[model samples]
Target: MELKIDESIIKAYGFTHQNINIQQIGSGHINGTYLLTKLPSNEKFVLQYINTNVFTNPKAIANNIQAVASFLNQQFPTYLFPAPLLTVNGENMATYNGSYWRLSPFVDDTVALDTLSSPKQAYEAAKQFGKLSRLLNGFDSNKLQATIIGFHDLVLRFEQFENALANANTAFKTKAAEEIEAAINYQYILNNYLEIKDVLPDRVMHHDTKISNVLLDQNSYEGVCVIDLDTLMPGKFISDLGDMMRTYLCEFSENETDFSKINIREDYFAAMIEGYLYEMGSILTKKEKEAILFSGKYIIYMQALRFLSDYLNGSVYYPIHYPTQNLDRAKNQLKLLQELVDNEEKLQDIINQSLLKVI
Candidate 1:
C-alpha cells in the first residue's frame, strides 16, 4: 500500500493548512521526511513516515523523541526544534496505510547544511551540540531503550568481527581471515575504553553526531540546533566525538575502493577536536581527556570490523553497492584507523591545547 498523508488530519492537530503541499525533502536511509507547506497561512511543517520495519517499535521510538523534546522544552524553552503532535487519541503516532507516521511543528527560517562549508560552521556545530548535551545532563539514561544492542560498544564489535571470520564462504574466507588477523590487535586499541569513565562526563548521548544534522542559520552561518534524534541514547563522550569526526574530518569518500588514496585531514581533525573541547571540556573528566585520541582509533576499528563482518555475511546489516563494497568500506576505515594510531601523539596535543583554551 502506498502511504499518503492526510491533509485534514494535520488540521486536526492545529496546523490549520487550507491548501496542502508535501514535498519529499530528505535522503535519510531510514525514515521518510517531507516538507509540508500550508498555502493559505504560508506556514511549514515536517511530516515523517516512521519505518516500523526498521524501528520495530514505532510507539517507543515516538515516545523517546517526545521525551527528549519535552525535556528540551523545559530547559531551553526559548529555542525550538520540531515538536511532535499528539493525536486526538493522546498518542503521538498514527497508523497510516499500514505504516506509522508522525507530525512535528517545524522551525521556520532554519536550514540544515549538506556540508560543513567553513570553520565557523564547525565551531557552531560543536557549540550547539554541546548545548544539547548540557540540556540533557540530568536525564535518566536507563529510561531510554538501546534501540540496537551494542550500538557503539567496541567489545561487542570485536565479537562480531570474530563471527565474520568464522562464517566467511570459501571464496572469500582466506582473504577475510587475513583481514581479520590484521585487525586482531586493533581490538586492543580500545583496551582503555573503561578508563574514560573516570575523567569525562556522561549523559544521554546523540550517538550519530554528523555535522549535517546541525541546523545552521543561513545569514550568519551559526548553528541553531541539531536534528535527527533517532539514535539518541546513553553513551560516553567518545561515542559522540568519534562519530562526529568519522563524518566530518575525513577527506576521502567512505566507500573509496582505492585504499592508497584514503588520507586523514590533520586540519579537519584539529578543527573538530578544538570545537568539541570548546563545548565539553569543563564537564569532561581527566580519564576522558587521556582517551580522547584513542576514541578516534577505537571507533574506527569497531566500524571497520562491522563493515567487514557485514561483507563476509553477505550484506545483512548495512546497504552495499556491490559484492565487495562492504569489504572496500572496511579497508578504508581500517586505513583511517591506522592513520589515527600513527598520529596519536599529535592528536593528543590537539586535545590538550583545546582543553587549555576552554579552561
Candidate 2:
C-alpha cells in the first residue's frame, strides 16, 4: 500500500517534477525510503533519507557500497548491485537542509517481500545473502567502514545493558524482574561470543538480513539481490546468518505482543541452513562452521539485551508504541532464545546435514 508523502523532497534532490507521485516504500525501521514516479514520463527512482543519528556517517555508507560495487563488477559483473546514483555534481550522496539523500536505480520487475510465504523463500533469501558473502570473500575487508560501530558487537551491547540496568529506575527494574533474570541468564551467549569472536574471520557482511532487505523476482520469488545497504559493513558471518535465523525461523515478528504466536518453525530453520551453507559451506572456516547453532543465540540474545536495555533506560533508544513495548519485545526475544536453546542439538544436526549436502 502506498502512503501519502509530501513531494517537497523531490526538489531537495534537484528533481523539478511538480506532479510526481510519492509513495513510502519498504519495511525499514531506520530510514525513510520513497518510490517517486514522475507523471507523463513515468520515470522512477528509489530515494532514501539516511538516519544520520544511527549511522553518524553517510559518506562512509556511499563509499562502502561504491567500493563493493566496484569489486563486484570486476569479479562478478552480472551481479545486480544498484549502487547509489551520483548527483548532478558527480557526488554519490546529496545533502539538502542538513539531511543526507541517496537516489538509486529502481529495479523494475522485482518485489520486496514483507513475509516468507514458504520455506523456499527462506532458502532463497538465505542463499542470496550467502552468495553475496561468498562472492565478496576475496575483496579487501579494510576498504569497508563500520557503518554503525558495534552494530552487531554482542559484547558491547551486553555492557550497555549492564550500565542501563545499573542506572535504571527502581520501579522499572521491579516491573521487569522476570525479564531481567532472563537477560542475565542469557549471558552465556555473550561469554561464548567473547571466546570465539577473535577466531572467526570478519567478512563483508550485510549486518541486517531481514527478508524485506531482499528483492525477489516478482513471479518466481527467487532472490534478485539484497537492498537497503546502509547497514552494509565488515562484520562476522553470524550477523547475517543469525539475523536470518532470528527473523526467518519464526513466523511472527519481535513486536508482536502475543507471545503464543511466536513459536519456532523448524522447517524454515532447516531450509535457511540448507540455503546459507549451500553458498558459504565451501567458504566458511571450521571455526565459523562450529558457531552455526550459536548464530541464532548471538543475534537473538543481543537484540533482547538491546530491547531490555532500552526498556530499563525508560525507552530512550527504540521507539515505543505503548508503555512497555520494549519490555514486551525483550520478553518476546528471550522466549525465542529459550526455544532456540531447547532445540540446539536438533538444529545442529540440521546444520551438519546441510554442510554434508553442500559438500
Candidate that would win on lDDT: 2
RMSD of 1: 2.6
The Cα error of candidate 2 at residue 232, in Å, is: 0.9
Q: What is candidate 2's lDDT per residue for 18-93, written digit by digit as tens?
A: 6676778777777888887877788788988888888899899999999999999999999998888887677888
Error at 96, model 2, angstroms: 0.7
- Tell me how far the alpha carbon of residue 47 in candidate 1 is from the true structure, in angstroms, after superposition: 1.0
Model-by-model lDDT, in order? 0.74, 0.88
- Residue 15 in model 2: lDDT: 74
Error of 1 at 274 (Å): 2.4
Q: What's the lDDT for residue 163 in model 1?
A: 84
What is the TM-score of each predicted model, taking all chains together?
0.90, 0.95
- Give candidate 1 regions above 4 Å deviation: 1-3, 6-18, 194-202
Stretches of candidate 2 above 4 Å error?
A: 1-14
